[model samples]
Target chain A: MLRRKQFWFAIMAILPTFAIFGWVRLFPIIETLRLSMHEWNLLSKNKPFVGFQNFIELFSDNQFMDALTNTAVIAFGAMAVTIPMSMVLAAIIYHRTRSRFSGFYETAVFIPHVVSLVPAAMAWKWIFDAKLGPLNAIIMGLGGDALPWLFDPVLSVICIIFLVSWQTLGYGVLIYLVGFRNLPKSVFEAAQLDGANGFQSFLYMSVPLLKPITLYVSVVTLISGFNVYAQAYVLASDTQGAPGRQVRVLVLDMLENSFQNFRVGYAAAEAVILLSIVLLLTMIQFGLLRGKGGR
Target chain B: MSAKARARRTNFLLDVTLFVICILLLTPLILLIANGFKTPQEMLVWPPTLFPKDPTLENFHKVFTETPLLQWMLNSFLFALLSTVAIVATSALAGYIVGKFPFRAINIIFILFLATAIIPFEVYMIPLYFQVKALGLLNSVGGLLVGYLVMSFGIFLIRQNVIASIPDELLEAARIDGAGELWIFWYVVLPLLRGPLAALAVLAFFQAWTAFAWPIIVMTRKKSFTIEVGLANFQSAYTVDLSLLSAASAAVMVPSVLAFVLLRRNFVEGIAASGMKE
Candidate 1:
C-alpha cells in the first residue's frame, strides 16, 4: 500500500514537468513535422495538405538555397575554427593549473560565452566595421588594404564565421578543460617515462583520448552555428546602410517566411530540415561516443 | 642556465603568451566597454581610439532618457527571474521524483526528458510562436516565457545531481518516520538539492536574460521588449549613434558579465557537467 502510494506521488510530482515539456517542446516539434507537409498562411482557417510540395518549392527557391548554404558553411566553419583553437587553449590552461592567474585565464575566456549575444555580436560588428572600425585600421597600419569586413559577399560570411567561433570558443575551451582534468594522469606519466615530450604526448594521447569531448564540443558548436540568427541579424542590420550585407541564414529565412512573408507551412519545411540536420548530428555524436565507450 | 631556471623562463614565456591570447579573446568586450563612454563625434575619429579620447557618460544618459530602456530591463528581469523560478521549481520536482523513484516507467520518462535536449529550439520555435499566438499571448511578457519555463537540460542536470548527491535511505527513513511525501520532500530533499538547484537557477536565469530570438518575436512593442530585443531595436533607430549603441549594449552586458564573474564556479561546473553528460 505504501509503495503504491509513493508511486502515485511520484507520478503526480512529475506530471506538471512532463506536461510542460510535452506541450511546450514535444508537441510543437510534432506539429512542425505535420505543418511541413501543408500550406497555410497566418490568417487561413484551413491548412491544405500539400505533401512534399513545400520541400520541392524550397529546393527551387534561391533565397532558401542561399540561406541553407550560408548556414552550413557558417556551422562547419565555426566548428573547424573552434575545435582546434579551444583544444590547444584548454590544454594550455589545463597544464598551467598551478598558476594563480589560471582562474583569471579561464574566466577571461569564458566571459564571452556568458556575455549577452546581441551585445557581443554588436561589439564584433563594431570591430569589423570597414572604414571606422579598429580591425581595418590595424590592417591598414600593417600595410594591408582595408578590406570590407561586413559588406563584401565572402568577407561578410567570414565575419559571421568569426563571430560564431568567437562566442563558441570559450564554451569549447571550458568543456575541453574539463575533459583534460578527467583524463587519467598515469597515461601521461607513462608517456613521459617512454621519453615522449609534452607536445608529442598531447598530440598522440590527449587528442585521441579526448575524442568524446571533441565530438561533444563540435556537436554543440555546430548545432549553435546552424541555429545562427541574431549574430547575422545584428551585424548587417544597419538601416541607414553604410555597406552591410544581410547574410541570409536558415533561422532568419524561416523567420522571414513565417512572420514577414507569412508562409507558415513553408517555414515549417525549413524548420523540418533544420530539425533533421540537428537530430542527425546528435545521433552521430551519441553513436560515436557510445562506440568509444563500448570499446 | 640551471634546468630549474630554464623551466621558470619557459613558464614565464607561456604566461606572456596566455596573457596576449586572453587580451585578444577579450578585445571585443574591451572595445564595447571603452567605446561606451566615447562621445558620438569621438567614435568617428580616425585611428579609432581604444580608450575614449575624452570619456563621458552622456551616451548612457541619453539612452535612459531617450529610449524605453528601463521598461525593457524590467521586462527582461521579470522574464529572467520568473522563468528561472519556474524552471528550477519544475525541474527540481520532476528531477527529484525521476532521480530517486524506482517506478517501472521512470527510466523511459527520464530518457524522454533528456531526448528533448537534442531538439534545438529553432526546430520548434515556429509552432511554439503559433501556439503562443493562438493563446492570445502575442506581445506579452507571458508569451516570452512560455518557451523558457522548462529547460530539458536543467531537468537532466538536476536529475544527475540528485542521483549522485541524494541517497535513497534518507528518503526511506523519512517516510518510515511518518513524514508525508510532500513534507519529506520539502524538508529533506530540497536542502540537499541546494547546490545543484542554485546552479540550475543561475544557468536558467542567464539563458533567459540573454535570450534574443524568441523575445524579439514575442515582444514586438517597444515597451514590451526585453533588454536584448530593445537594444537591437535601439540600434536600428539610432543608426549612426554608435556611442549610444555601445552604451546600451554595455548596460545590457554588465549584469550578465558581473553575474558570471561572481558565480563563475556554478556557470563553469554547470556547463562542464552538461557537456560531459551529453
Candidate 2:
C-alpha cells in the first residue's frame, strides 16, 4: 500500500505540468490537424467538414507555393553561408587568440543573439531604409547610385536572409567555440609534430572533427529559419511580404490566410505542412547524431 | 625570417582582422544607440554624420511623455517574471519526479514533454489563438501568460540537469531517515537544483521577454501590450520620427541585453545546452 501511494504521489506531482501541456500544447496541435480539414473562419457559426480540400488547395495555390519556396530559400540560403562563416570565425578566435580580449570578441559577436528580435529588426529596417537611410547615404557619397534594399524583390529576399544570418551568426560562433574548446589539445599537438601547418590542420582535422556541432547548428538554424516570421514582419514595413510577396515566409503566409483573409482552414493546412517539415528535419538530425554514436 | 618572427607577424595580422570584424559587427548597434540621441533634423541629413551634430534628450523625453512606454515595459516585466517563476517552479517539480523517480509511466510523460519542444509555435499558432480566445483570454495578460506556461524546453532542461547532477544516494539517505517524498524534494532536491534553476530562469526570462507573435495576437489593447509589441506599433504610428523610433528600440532592448551581460556565463551555458543536447 505504501508503494502504491508513492506511485500515486509521484503521478500527482507531475500532473500539473501534464495538464498544462495537454490543454495548451498537445490539444492545440491535434486541433490544428482537425481544423485543417474543416472550413471555418473566426466569425463562422458552422465549421463545415471539407476533407482534404484545404490540403488540395494548398498545392494548387500560387501564393502558398511561393511562401513555401521562399521559406526553403531563406532557411537553406542563410544556413549555407552562416555555418561555414561561423566555423571560420570560431576557428580564428579560438585557435589564434591567447589574450584576454578573446572574451570581448565573444561578447561582441553575441550581442545580437541576446537582443529582442523586434528591436533588432527595427534597427535593420532603419539601416536599410531608403532616401534618408545611412546605407544609401554612404553609397551616394561613394558616387554610387542608391540601391533599393527592401523595395526590390530580389533585394528584399536578400535583406531577409542577411538579417537572419546577422542575428544567428553569433550563436553559431559561440556554439562552435564550445566545440573547439572541447576538442582534445593532444591531437593538435600531434598534428603539429607531423608538420601540419595551421591552415592545413584546420581544413582537415578541425573541420572534420567539428562535424557534429556543425550538423547540430545547421538543424537548429534550419528550424528557426522555417519559422521565420517576426523579422520579416517587422522589416518589410508591409507585413504581407512586400515587393510582390518575394520574402513572404511560411509563417507570414499562414498569418495572412488565417487572420487577414479569414481562411483558417487553409492556414491550418499550412501549419500542418510546416509541422511535417520540422518533424522530418528533427528526425534527420537525430539519425545523423545517432550514426555518430550520440552526443 | 626566423620562425618566432614569422609567428608574431601572423598573430598580429589575425588580431587586426578580428578587430576589424568585431567593429563591423558592432556598427549597426552603435548606430542605433547613436541615432537615438540625435534630433529628427540631424537624422535626415544626407551621408548622415556618424555622431549626432547636436545630441539631445528630447526624443527619450518625448517617448516617455507621449507614449505608454512605461506601462508596456511593466507589462513585459510582469509577463517575463511570472513566466520565469512558473517555468522554474513547475519544471523543477516535474523534472525531479520524472528524472529521479522510477515510475512506470515516466517514460511516456517525458516523451510527451520532449515532443512539444519540436513543434514550432507557428505550427499550432492559429489553433492556440482560438483556444485562448475560447477561454476568454484574448486581450488579457492572464491569457497571454497561459500560452507561455507550457514550457517543454524548460522541463527537459531541468530534467536533464537533475539527472546528471543529483545523486540517487542522497535521496536514499533521506528516505532512510523517514523523510517524506515531498519533504525530501523541498529540502534536498530543490536546494541542490539552484544552479540549473538559475540557468533555466535566465533562458525562460529572455524567451518571454522577446516573444512577439503571440503577444501581438492576444494583447490587442494598448494597455496590455508588451514592450516589443508596443515598439512595433510605435514604429507604424510615428513613421517619420526616426529619432523617436531609435530611442524606443534602444529602450526595449535594454533589459534583455542587461540581463545577458550580467549572467553572461549562465546564458551561454543554457543556450549551448539546449542546442547540443537531444
Candidate 3:
C-alpha cells in the first residue's frame, strides 16, 4: 500500500507537465507531419492526402527556395559576424578591467538583449530611416546621396542581419567572458615563459581553449537565426518581405502562407522542412562536440 | 620609459577604447529616449541631433492620455506574473520528483520534457493556433498562459539544481523522521531550491514579457493585446509620430530592464551555467 501510494504521487507530480507537453508540443508536431502530406485550406471540412505532392511543389517553388537561401545566409552570416566580434570584445574586457566597473560594461552590452525585439527593431528602423535616420542623415550631410537602407533588397537583408547581430552580441560576449575567466592562469604564465606575445598567445592558446564555447555559441546563434521572424517582420513593416521578398526567411514565409495566403497544407510542409533543418544542425553540432570529447 | 609606466599607459588606452565601444553600443538606445522628448518639427531636421533641442514630457503625456497603453501594460504584467508563477510551481514539483525520487520511469519522462527544447515555435505555430482555437481560448490570456507553461528548459534547470545541490540523504532523513513526501518537499527541498527557482523566475518572466509572435497571432482582439503586440500595432498605425512611438517603446522596455538590473547576478549566472552545460 505504501509503495503504491508513493508511485501514484510520483505519477501525479509528473502528469501536469506531461499533459501540457503532449497537448501543445507533441501533438502539434505529429499533426504537422500528417498535415504536410495533405491539402487543406483551413476552411474546408476535408483534408485530402496528397502523398508528398506538397513536398514536391515546395522544392519547385521559387519563394520557398528564396526563403531557404535567405535563412541560410542570415543564420551563417549572423554567427560569422557575432562570434568573432563577441570574442574580441570579451577578450578586451577580460584583459583590461580590474575594477567592479566591468560589470557595468557587461550590463550595458546586455541591455539590448533583454529588451523586447519589437522596440529594438523599431529603434533600428528609426536609425535606418531614409530621410530622418542618423545613418542616412550623416551620409547626406557629407555631400553624398542618401542610401536606401531598407528599400534595396540586398541592403535590407544586411540590415536584418545587423539587427540580429546587435541584439545577440551581448549574449555571446557574456558567455565567452565566462569562458575567458575560467581559463587556468598557469596556461598564460606558461605562454609568457615560452616568449609568446599577446597576439600569438591569443591566437594559439585562447582560441583553441575556447573552441567548445565557440561551438556552443554557434549552435545557439544558428538556431536563433533559423527562428528569425519578428525582426524581419518589424523591419520590413509587414509587407511580406518588402522590396521583392529579399528578406523573407523560412518562418516569415511560413507565417505568410498560413495566415495571409491561407495555404495551410503547404505551410505545414514548410514547417516540417524547417524542423528537419534545425534538428539536423543541432545533431551535427552534438556529434562534433562528442567526437572531439572522445579523443 | 620604464616598463611599469608603459604598462600603465597601455591599460589607460585600453580603458578609453572600451569606454568608446560602450558608448557606441549605447547610442541607439540613447537616441530612442532622446527622440521621445523632441517636438515634431525638430524631429524632421537635416541632421538629427543626439540631444533634443527642446526636451519635453508632452509625448509621454500624450501616450498615456491618448492610447490604451496602461491596459496593455496591465495585460503584459498579468501574463508575465501568472506564467512565471505557474512555471515555478510546475517546474519545482516535476523537477523534484524526477530528480529526487528513484522512480523507474523517470529517465523517459525527463527525456520527453527535454525533447520539446529541440523544436522551435515555428514548427508548431499553425497547429498550436488551431489547438488554442479549438479549446475556445482565442484572444484570451488563458491561451497565452497555457502556451508558455511547458518550459522545457525551466524543468531541466530545476532538475539539475535539485539533483546537484539537494542531497538524497536530506530527503531520506526527513522520511526517517515520519515526514510525508509532500511535507519533505514543501519544507525541505523547496527551501534549498530558492536560488534556481529565482533564476528560473527571472528567465520565465523575460520570456513571457518580451514574447511577440504568438501573442500577435492569438490575441487578435485589441483589448487583449500584450505590450509587445500593442507596440507593434501602435508603430504600424502611427508611423510618423516618432516622439509618441519612442515614448511608448521606452515605457515598454523599462520594466524588463529594471527586473534585469535587480536580478543581474542570477540572470548572468543562470545564462552562463546553461550555456556551458550545453
Candidate 4:
C-alpha cells in the first residue's frame, strides 16, 4: 500500500458504509422531514406545499391521541415492572446462587430472548384467547370467568405488555446478569464482613452496584419498547383490522396514514415526530443516567 | 448430626426447585415442539395434552406442500446472510475508523448512531417505503438489505466491544512496524473482534430474519416477502390454513433457533463483554 495512498485506502474502506447509511438511513430521514412540507398523495393531480398543516392535523386527530396514549401506557407500564424484577432476579442468580444453576436458569430465560415478536405474539394471543385459550381455561379451572382478552381494549393492551415483557425478559436477564458479574466482589464481601447479611447485603451493596445495569436496561428497554410494532401487527392483523383496530399503536397508525391511505405528507410529519421523540428520549435518558457519574 | 443431615437435604431440595423453575421457562417451547407435529384438530383437542398420540408427519407435509415455506426459508437465509455480511463488513470498517484515528466529529457521530438504536424501524417504515418506491427499490430483496443495514446498532455494539477489548497500543505498535491500516485491521483487529463480531452476527441475523414491520410496509407483494412476513400473510384473509402457517413459522423459527444455540457462547460473551450503556 502506498503511504499517502494508505489514507485514501482507510477512507475507501468506510466509503461503502457511508454510501449505504446515506442512502437508506440518511436520505429517508431527510426526505421524511422534507415531505412533511408538501402534500403529495398518490391519487392527487397537482402536488402542493402544505407547510405545517400536516403536523397540525396530526396533533388534532383523535386516533393519533389514542395511539400515543396506548403506546406510552404499554412502554412505561411494562418497563416499570420489568426493570425492578430483572434487578431482583439478576441479584438472586448473581449473589445467592453459587452453583451452575444460574447458568442453566439464565439460558432458559434468555431462550425467549431469541424468539421473535411475531410468533410470541401469536402464542400469547392463544394464551389470552377468550373461548379456547389456556388463560381462560386456567381461569375457569380456578372457578373464574372467561374474559374477553383482545376485545377489551384495556385487557388487550395489558396482554400485549405481558407478551413484550416475556419476549424481553431474557435479554434483560442476559444484560443484567453480565452487569452483576462485573460488579466488584470486594464491595459485597466487605458488606458481608460488615455484618450486612441477606437482604441488607442486597440493599446496601447489590442495588447500588447494579445502578449502571439498571440505567442501561431502562434506556435499551425503553427504545425496544417504543419500537414495538410486530406484536401489535401480528396480533391485530396487517395494518388495522375489525373491531376498529383497537390495539392500533402509533406505528400502525403511521403506516395506515402514510402507506395505506396515501397521506404521505401527513404520515411523513408523524414519522418526524416519532423519530424526534425517540431521539429526544434517548438523549434525556443518557442525560438523566449520566447525572450521578452516568456511564 | 441429624440437624446437619436435614440442612443438606433441604439444600438439595432447593437446587431441584431451581431446576424446576428453569424447566418452567422452557415449557412453552417444549409444548410447541411436541405439538408442531400434530394435526390442527389434534392440537385443538384438549384435555390439554402434552404429547400428540399419533405425532403425525402430516402437518410437516402440509407445511411444505401448501405454503411457499421453503421459498420463504430461502429468502430468510438470503436476508440474514446478506444483512450479516453487510453489518459485519461495514461495522468493522466504521468501528475501526472511530476506534482508531480519533476525530473531532467521532463523539457526535457515535452518539448519533447510538441514538439510532432508539428510533425503531417502525418510525422509519413509512418514510422508508416511500423512499424505496421513489428510488425504484420496491419488492427488491437487496433494497430490504440496505434498509436493515441502515439501522447500525450492530456497528455501535461491535465498536463498543472493539474499544473494550483491543488496546490502542496494538494499533500504535502496528503503525510503527509499518503494518498499514488495512493490514492492522485484517490481521490484528478483526481476529480480536471475532468474539463480539460473531455474537453481533447472530443477533443481526435474528433481527433481519425475523423482521416483519418493514417487510410489511416496503414489500408490497410476495415476490420479495421474507419468512416472517410471508408467515404472517396466512392469517391476513389470504389463507386460512392454520397448520401450514404454524409449519411456516416453525421453518422461520428453526434456523434462528439453531443460530442462537450454535452461537450461544459468543452471544453471552459479547453482551457480557460490553457490560451495559448505563
Candidate 5:
C-alpha cells in the first residue's frame, strides 16, 4: 500500500510539468507539422488539405529563395567567425587563470551575451549607420572610402553576420572556458616537459581534445544564426527614407507570411523546413555525444 | 636572464594583449551608454562625437514622458518574475521525482523532458501562437507567460543537480521517520537544492527578461510590449531624436546588465553547467 501510494505521489508530482511541456513545447511542433499540410489563412473555418502544395510553391518563391540563401550564409558565416575566435580567446584566458584580472575579463566578454538583444542590435545598427555613424567616420578619417555598411546588398548581410557573431561570441567563449577548465592538466604538463611551446601545445593538444566542444558551440551558434530575425529586422527593416535593403531571413519571412500576408499555411510550411534543419543539426550533436561516450 | 624570467615576460605581454582585446570587445557597449547622454544637436553634428559634448538627463526624461516606457518595463518585469517562479517550481517538482524516484518508468519521463530541448522555438511558435489564440490569450500576460512557464533546460539542470548532490538516504531517513514525501522534499531536498535552484532562477529570469522574438509576436499592442519590443519600436517613433532612442535602449539594458554583474558567479556557472551537460 505504501509503495503504491509513493508511485501515485510521483505521478501526481510530475503530471503538471508533463502537461505544460506537452501543451506548450511538444504539441506545437506536432501541430506545426500538421498545419503545414493544410491551407488556412488563420481565419476561415473551411480548411483544405494541400498535401505538400505549399512546400512545392515555396521552392520557386523568390523571396523565400533569397531568405534561404541569406539565412544559410549568415548561419554558416557566424559559426565560422565565432568558433575559432572564441576558442583562441578561451585559450588565452585559461592560460592566465591565476591572474587577478581573469574574473574581470570573463565578465567583460559576457556582458554582451546578457544584454537585451534588441538594444544590443540597435547599438550595432548605430555603429553601422551609413552616413552619420562612427564606422564610416573612422573609415573616412583613415583615408578609406566610406562603404555603405547597411545599404549595400552584400554588405548588409555581412553586417547581420557581424552582429550575430558579436552577441554569440561571449557565450561561445564562456563555454570554451569551461571546456578548458575541465580538460586534464597532465597532458599539458607532459607536452611542456617535452619542450613544446605554449602555442604548439594549444594548437595540437587543446584543439584536438576540445573538438567536441567546438562542434557543440558551432551547432548552437548555427542554430541561433538560423533563427536570426531581430538583428536583421532592426538593422535593415523598411524605414522612411534611408532604409537599407531588407535582408530577407527565414524567421522574418515566416513572420511576414503568417502575420502580414495572412498565409498561415504557407508560413507553417516554411517553419517546417526550419524545424527540419534544426532537428537535423540536433541529431548530429546527439550522435556525436553518443559516439564520444561509446568510445 | 633566466628561463623563468623569459616566461614571465611572455605572460605579461599576453595579459596586456588580452586587456586590449577586452577593451575592443567592450567598446560598442560603452558607446551604447555614452551616446545616450548626447544632446540632439550633438547627435546630428558632423563627425559624430563618441562622448557627449554636454551630457544631460533630458533624453531620459523624454523617454519616460513621451513614450510608455514604464508600462513596457513593468510588463517585462512581471513576465520575467512570474515565469521564473513558475518554471522553478515546476522544474523542481518534476526534477525531484525524476532524479530520486526509482520507479520503473522514470527513465522515460526524464528522456521526454530532455527531448524537448532539441526543437527550436521558431519552428513551433506559429502553432504556439495559434494555441494561445485558441485559448483567447492573445495580447495578454497569460499569452506571453504561456510558452515560457516550463523550460526544458531548467528541468534538466535541476535534475542533474539533484542526482549529483542530494543523496537518497536522507529522503529515505525522512520517510522512515513518518514524514510525507512532499514534506521531506520541502524541508530536506529543497535546502540541498538551493544552489542549482538559484542558478536556474537566474538563467530563467534572464531568458524571460531579454526575450524578444516570441514576446514581439505575442504582444502586438504598444501598451503590452516588453522592453525589447518597445525598444525596437522606439527606433521608428523617435527616428529624428537619436538621443531618445539611445536613452531607451540604455534603459532597457541596465537591469539585466546590473543583475548579471551582481550575480556574475551564478550566471556564469549556470551557463557553464548547461553547456557542460550538453
Candidate 6:
C-alpha cells in the first residue's frame, strides 16, 4: 500500500519534468531525425520528405569531408597535447610545491577557465591579427618577418587551437589538483620510504594511482575540443576556412547550413552525422582508457 | 646548504616559475584590460602598449553609448538567474528521485541524462531552432530561458553533485520515518545537496551568461541582443574598431567575472567537480 503511494508521488513529480523533457529535448531530436530524411527549407510551406537524400548528399559533399577532417585533427590534437600535460601538471603540483603561493597561482590560473568565451575569443583575435596585431608586433620585435595568423590556411587552424586552449590548461591543472588533493597522502610517504626518488615516486606511485581522474580529464578534454565554436564565430565571424575553405569545422558547417543557408533539413543531416562521430569516438576513448588503466 | 634549506630554495624557484607561467596564461585578459583604456589612434600603433599611454574614456563612452550593453547585461543576468533557479529546483528534486528510488530503470535514466552531455549542442542546433520557432518564441526572452533550461549539461552536472552527496542510508531512513519521498527530499536531502547545488547554480549561471551561439539564432532583433552579440558588432565588412571593441569586450566579461568572484569557491569547485566526474 505504502509502496504504491510513494511510487505515485514520484510519478507526480517526474510528470511535468517528463513533459518538459519530451517537448523540449527529446521531441526535437526525433524531429531532426525525421527532417534529416527530407529536403526542404524551413521557409517552404509544401514539403516533401525525400528519404535519406540529404544524408546521401552529405556523403558526397566535399565541404562535409573537409569539416570532418578538420574536426578530427583538432579534437585529436587537443587530446594528445592536453592529456599528458595535465598529468605532468598534476604530478608536479602535487609533489613540487609547498608554499602559500601555490594557492594564489592555482586561483590565478583558474580564472581563465571561467572567463566568458566572447572576450576570450576577442582577445585572441587581437593577439593574432595579421596586420597591426600583437602577434606580428612580437614577431617584428624579434627581428623576424610576420606570418599571418588567421588568414593563412595552416596558421588559422593553429589560432583556433590556441584560442580554445588559452585557459584549458588551467582547467586540466585545477581538476587534476582536486583529484590529487583527494589522494591519501600516506601512499606517497610510503613510496618515499621505499627508496623511491622524485620521478620514481610520481611514476611508480602517483601516476599509477591517479587513474580515475586521468581518464576523467581526457574524456572531458576530448569533448570540450569538439565543443569549440565561440572562437571561430566571434573572431573569424563564421569566416573560418577562409583563404580557401581551410578552417570550416563541423559546427561551422552546421551553423552555416542552418543559419546562413536556412536549409534546415540538410543541416539536420550534418548534425546527426556529427552526433554519431562524437558519440562513437567518446565511447572508444573511454573503453580504451578502461582497458589500459587497470580499472 | 642544509637539506631543509635546499628543499625550501627549490620550492621557491618552482613557485617563481609557476607565477611566470600563470602570467602568461592570463596575458590575453591583461591585454584586453590594457587596451580597453587606450585611444583608438594609440591602439593602432606598431607595438601595443603595456599600459594605455593616452588613457581615455572615449572608447568606454562609445561602448556605453553606442552598444546596447546595459540591456544586454540585464538580459544575461535574468537568463542566468532563471537557469540557476530552474537547475537547482529541477535537479535537486530529480536527483533525489534517482537517489532515493531503488528502481533499476532510474540508473539507466540517469545514464541517459549523463550520456546526453557528451553530444555537442551543434547536433541539436538546427532542429531545436525550429522547435523554438514553432512555439512562437523567436526574438523573445522566454525562448532563450526555455532553450537554456533544456540543457543536458546542467542537469547532468547537478545530478553528479546529488549522486555524490546523498547517501543511501539517509534516504532509506526518511522512508522508514513514514515520510514520503518528496517529504524526505524537502526536509532532509536538499540541505545536504546545498554545496553542489550552489556549485552547479554558479556554473549554470555563467554558462547561461556566456551563451553566444543560442542567442544568435534566437534573438535576431537588435533590442533583443545579448552582450555577446552586442560585442560582435565591433566587426563588419568594412572596419574593425579595436579600442571600442576592447571596451565592449570588457563590458561583456565584467558581469560574469563579478558573478564568479562573488561565488568564487563554488565556481572553482563546480568546475573541478565537472572535470573530476566526467
lDDT of 4 by residue, B160-217 (tens): 7777888988877888898977788899999998877887777677778778777776
The iRMS of the candidates, in order, is: 1.5, 2.4, 2.3, 3.2, 1.7, 2.8
Best by lDDT: 1
- Give candidate 4's root-mean-square deviation (CA, Å): 3.1
Q: Report how far off residue B161 is in candidate 5 (Å).
A: 1.0
TM-score of chain A of each: 0.96, 0.92, 0.93, 0.92, 0.95, 0.88
Candidate 5 lDDT over residue span B1-278, tens digit each: 89999989988998998899889888888898888899888888879899998999998998898899999999999999999999999989998888887797766888888876878888889889989988998889899999899988888888889999988788778889999988988999999999888989999999998887899899999899998888877767656677788888888888778889999988887899878775
Candidate 2 structure, TM-score to reference = 0.96
Better of 1 and 3 by TM-score: 1
Clashing residue pairs in candidate 5 are none
Tens digits of per-residue lDDT for model 5, A201-295 = 99999998998888889899989999998888788753432324578899989988999889898999999999889889988987987888821
Cα-based lDDT at residue A239, candidate 2: 30
Q: List, residue by residue over B1-278, the lDDT tens digit for candidate 6.
A: 99789878877776777778778878888889778898878877877676798888887887778667788777777888887787667776766665566466565666666666676666776777877888899887888877667555556665666677777787768778778766777798778878878887877788888887788788888788777765664465225678877888886776666666678888887777665543
Q: For model 3, how does the per-residue alpha-carbon lDDT over A192-246 read when each residue is reduced to its tens digit?
A: 8999977798889899888889988998999999989888778866322233433
Residue A209 in candidate 1, Cα distance off native in Å: 0.8
Best-first order by DockQ: 1, 5, 2, 3, 6, 4
Deviation of model 6 at B228, angstroms? 1.5
How would you encode candidate 2's per-residue C-alpha lDDT over A1-295 as one tens digit per residue? Answer: 7678678888999998888889888998999999999998889699999999999999999989988998899999899989998999999999665866888888888988888988898888878887667888888889999988877767878888998999899999999998999889999999999999999999999998988899989998999999988887788764322334336789878988998999999899999999999999989988998998874
C-alpha positional error of residue A219 in candidate 4 after TM-score superposition, expressed in Å: 2.1
Which runs in model 6 stand beyond 4 Å of their true positions?
Answer: A237-246, B104-108, B150-181, B237-239
Model 5 chain A is weakest, by summed lDDT over 10 consecutive residues, at A237-246
Candidates ranked by lDDT: 1, 5, 2, 3, 6, 4
User: CA shift at B60, candidate 1, in angstroms?
Assistant: 1.3
Give the CA lDDT, 0 to 100, for residue A143 in model 1. 95
Q: Which 10 successive residues of model 2 chain B have the least lDDT summed?
A: B231-240
lDDT of 5 at A219: 91
lDDT of 5: 0.88
The local lDDT score (0 to 100) that residue A43 gets in candidate 6 is: 78
Per-model TM-score, in order, reads: 0.97, 0.96, 0.96, 0.90, 0.97, 0.92
